[model samples]
Target: MSVESKTNAQVMTRVTVIGAVVDGLLGLLKIGVGFVSQSHALVADGVHSLSDLGTDVLVILAAKWSNEEPDANHPYGHDRIETLATLILGSVLLAVAGGIFYDSLQRFFDPSVAIELGIAAFAITVASIVSKEAIYRYTRHYAQLLNSKLLMANAWHSRTDALSSIAVLVGLIGVSFDLIWLDALAALIVAVFIAKIALTLLWDAMQELIDTALPEDQVTAIRAVALDVPGLRDVHHIRTRTMAGKTLMDLHLQVDPRVSVSEGHEIGCWVAASIRAQFQEITDITFHIDPEDDAEMDQEGPTSLRPLRREVLECLRADWGPLVDDAQIRLHYLRGAVDVEVVTSQPVTADVLKSKSRAVWLGRVTVLHPTVGDN
Candidate 1:
């Protein structure tokens, strides 16, 4: 997944390298023993083990490349490299499974395909089972510690090898009783397990590549966290997606319309901080500060079209004349119009108010004068 730290990446690399070495030894030993004993099931299991070497290399490369810092060209970082590697790993498994299945089917139909087994085949299968299982446990422990889904998937892949070896072992026992078909059957079963694991990995990687949203419960929790912030009037338009197990989110945070820009920004920062503190998976957050819900305004009519401050001020100066020049003007763009508030220490009669009413875009204008001190 997101190998944000060099230490985690090193752990992933070391684990995968160890698995690769083990896989190489077991793959060769099993294949050699299968040839000597004429056991197709052991051969199939050996092929599966060999396939792990390829994926182990893939994992090592992915772990290294995916942990790279965001560059000028790749601003989102290299997380997707790990995802792509996973997809490729799945495809490799599927291909290996298909080959094993075809070979097994041929052996099943051709009774001339002699099958034999002995203590060597049994010993190799047992050794593979024990070794692969240990690797699975070791990799899975670090996967959970680092929160790396890719590493965990590899761990399960190792477990599948152990399971397939068990199937092979059962077939070996059947061969001692002169049951030749059981070897082919065990090979077919191993193919099925590999295919199942492949399909699962492929599905998960595809979902991530397509930018699927996080689970509903997690999104709901994020929304709740944002709403809990004291200065937030409302939070909406919350969107979330994951990249290599890290979540990235964006949402709109509504605040008092009259609040200063700095205050609204501060509220957004607090909301982001609270969510980050609660959810460790969230890696990025983008907040859109909103004075009012733009969705609600759209229901009545379109309110997006409005005059800019420069145009509004020019209009005000033209209509209110020199009285607007000396006045402190505040313009609020809401509900398809501008609400102007003029604060000045000058008297304003009905005639002056009526003069500024010519502009249809102006909603209301309130004039205020300085008051004398009473105490």
Candidate 2:
């Protein structure tokens, strides 16, 4: 949800504008020529190009909104706006394919329909093929550079249209040779291609909406980065998802039981930065530091070995020889067990610190007293 860099906004704008202009001009020429010459195949291809124009508008809006910094309502930023655009793009492609297919099927059923071809139609159909293919290449190149899923969908969408125009050109040639059924067959093939692209895009976008994990290699790379950091014992519960083509992750990092809290926190920060440096697409990472796994956690609440505070005090006095009345006891309830730290001013021996009777009664015992330099 941080501020989007200027470079991303610039690339998205340039690619979208190029697609809109090229698609608009080509769509108009093909549709006009198709009707004047009574070429249904060219008209169908023209409609496909027009659909590209519609998606270009969606891309523009998605980019604008998604670039906005995180707001009160959308604390994650408007990244999902791009995903929504992708879904809409897929649905529109399917609808266009269905309509074209239905029209082509009708032509097959009706044999007496009049068919005509013109030299001008030939020129426009060839032009559509060349222009659309160029747009596809242009869009695809930038898509790879930006690592943008939405733009890549649009790129393949253009390619489908371009290939469909090739079908149109074949139909025009069929008319010249008096093989009228060829035009209908070509249109049907284009519909299949469009539908295939649509289904793929929809499936990928839906997975993201449901918070699917990244590929195994990507997750493994993240793990490698974290485990390489110093003072980290192990990592677990790693999770990842994408929003606006950027990966977001969260994981639990286990450290030594004796490490200080600040040191653990600093280590977590370093790990996050290291992963991000390796994968520029990773936008955020949340780290939960754990001294050990919570194995015996009770769903109800915190339960101590000695349920009564007085009982715990009596046991502590018996094990440690005697207790100072002013000693402070801090109970940490975790993983269905309590870690007891008794703050004292008296010195205790290592032998007494490792007493087996106390170990048997209390799972974990630690005494916090001043260092040797303290008076």
Candidate 3:
């Protein structure tokens, strides 16, 4: 693993461990006080805090496992593990929300279920609100620094607990004024808040799981960066997908047909470097050097059906008197046709180059005379 990746993992681990410790303490206090004081909202909020502990475990494990270096079995690394864990965390929240909603509705309708609130309940609710809010801010800061979806989800999870505690505080005030049903109503509101955050996390994880493309604006920016590379005629067939928060891309680049193979390869490398410099998230790139644009061509186009270099040379030698030696012949395959060049010391004519039995795949032919060298 790179030093940066290892540092990120360590940061995530430290943040989650701190949050877990706070969650464990607050959950026990809220649940205990809630039962003693008959506050349904407080109990529901306590359950929410405990649920956060479970997701904290998920985040820690994902951070450690996903940061491992790529192995032979998995060449792309294990970033997808974080995505899967995010999905699971969302599912767990959804189930917790449903349970809270059902219990709150039942308590709200029952006439005998009464809430008795005192100074103890109010003090606990206030403490929970302050503690959870602090944890939320801390986690969110690191999440943006690392650009981690899983950490972001956990950060929101902590904020929801703080918001739920606010609802509990309001319910406790109402119970103090002899309003019995307000405690259950507060719990129901907490359930709704949990469900909304859970659904959002679930949707984002699903999009990444299915390999959705990056946004259109980012793709356009990528194309612009690629076109700025020198010696590139055009670029086409740009394909992209996101894994975790990183991008993977492949594209086709067109260059001059007469350029040497080494030159074409150098151009491709320059394009890749330019793109990576512009977009830091793009870690993997594959470029296909093309002599011509073949995006609109069929699968069995002339590029695929064209003869190999050796076959083309044998045909040229048999048909043309000037093409007797392979050393003097050069061939370029472009746009489904072959352009041939022949070099010799003997005198040659345009008619001889053109009047030969031309194959359907041949496009243009040129003859060059050896300079300053006697036979």
Candidate 4:
């Protein structure tokens, strides 16, 4: 099985098992204490915990289905199933938040009812906070280490539960002060927080489902590695995306046109190897090779034309040595002649310099005037 599959299975197993145990026990305790103390807020919070049990089960189901290997029917695999699950979870959160807000609003309008608080309800809320915090930490640590989006979402879910418990604790204290409206108000705030978390998660997961590109920095790092490869002139058309805890990339590589097909292929393989070695996150790479000339032309224009003046100067220096000082070569391509000027340490006749220029030219380059010498 793939690393994603293993991680999903492990996270789901741990989360489901722990969630069932903690939520079950907390739900029972809160309900029992709330009923005896006549605390509606405690009862509502207990119901929320019960709802979490259902959500945890949903997470496990989603993780399992999402980790399935790619099939003919699903060429890209079932990775987006995790995103679908996150969307579902988000919807669930929104609905629950709406329900909680509505109930809290109704309670707010009815000021005649009195809220009762008990020591047992307060203790249960504290215990729930501790337990949920532990779950959040555990899930978040693994989520980051494995880069599992689904697990990270679930971790925040646990964190929201802890926050809700804190709200419950404050409400219970407000009840002691005869502030009956505070309990419902606190629950409403918790509901709003839950809704916000849901919206954020939904938006992020949707981006993933649509196969959004990885961050710019990551793409830049990949491109930098590609350019570092020997024999590679340039890298372009880099594209990257994430799927099931792995990254996939496709890019175009520019290499010398004179290189053979086998050599180009080898260079591409080396580039791919270098990138993967540097960044283990890249699980798949596809490269298209283009001739360096073709690639340059695609970006700008043909770079084949050399500076004739510079070439002539280089030719003079190579053939006649650096004995010629203040040397300059000017090209008049229209006239098919090169103007050469030189200052020699010793006095040299124009005829001797002309002979040297003709020798250096070897017939191709026409020397216009040796009389253009500075000294």
**For every model shown, what is its TM-score relative to the native structure?**
0.89, 0.84, 0.90, 0.72
Question: What does candidate 2's lDDT look like per residue over 171-244, in tens digits?
Answer: 77887888778877887898898899999989998998999999999899889989999989888888999986
> For candidate 1, which ten residues in a row score worst on lDDT?
295-304
For residues 1-375, could you state the per-residue lDDT of candidate 1 as single tens digits?
333468878999999999999999999987988888877766866776887898898899999998888889998888889888888877877886787688678878984563456788878989999999999999999988877778877887788778767766766676687776786788799889889988998999899899899989988999999999998988877888777778888888999877878999999999999999999989889999988887565346564578888888888778778887887887776656787878787888545775646778887677767686522
RMSD (CA, angstroms), candidate 1: 3.2
Model with the higher TM-score, candidate 2 or 4: 2
TM-score of candidate 4 on Cα atoms, chains taken together: 0.72
Q: Can you write out model 4's per-residue Cα lDDT over 112-228, one digit (the tens) per residue?
A: 543457788878889999999998898888778767777778888888889778767777787788787887888789889988988898888887778899999988988898898
Clash totals in order: 0, 0, 0, 0
In candidate 4, position 262 carries an lDDT of 85
Model 1: runs farther than 4 Å from truth?
A: 1-4, 31-48, 296-304, 349-355, 368-375
In candidate 4, which residue ranges exceed 4 Å CA deviation? 1-4, 36-38, 112-115, 292-375
Best by TM-score: 3
* Over 4 Å off, model 3: 31-48, 114-116, 298-304, 373-375
State which candidate, 1 or 3, has the greater lDDT: 3
Candidate 2 similarity to native, TM-score: 0.84
Candidate scoring better on lDDT of 1 and 4: 1
Question: What is the Cα-based lDDT of residue 222 in candidate 4?
Answer: 85
Candidate 2 segments whose C-alpha is farther than 4 A from its true place: 1-4, 31-48, 111-115, 295-335, 342-362, 368-375
- State the C-alpha lDDT per candidate: 0.82, 0.77, 0.83, 0.75
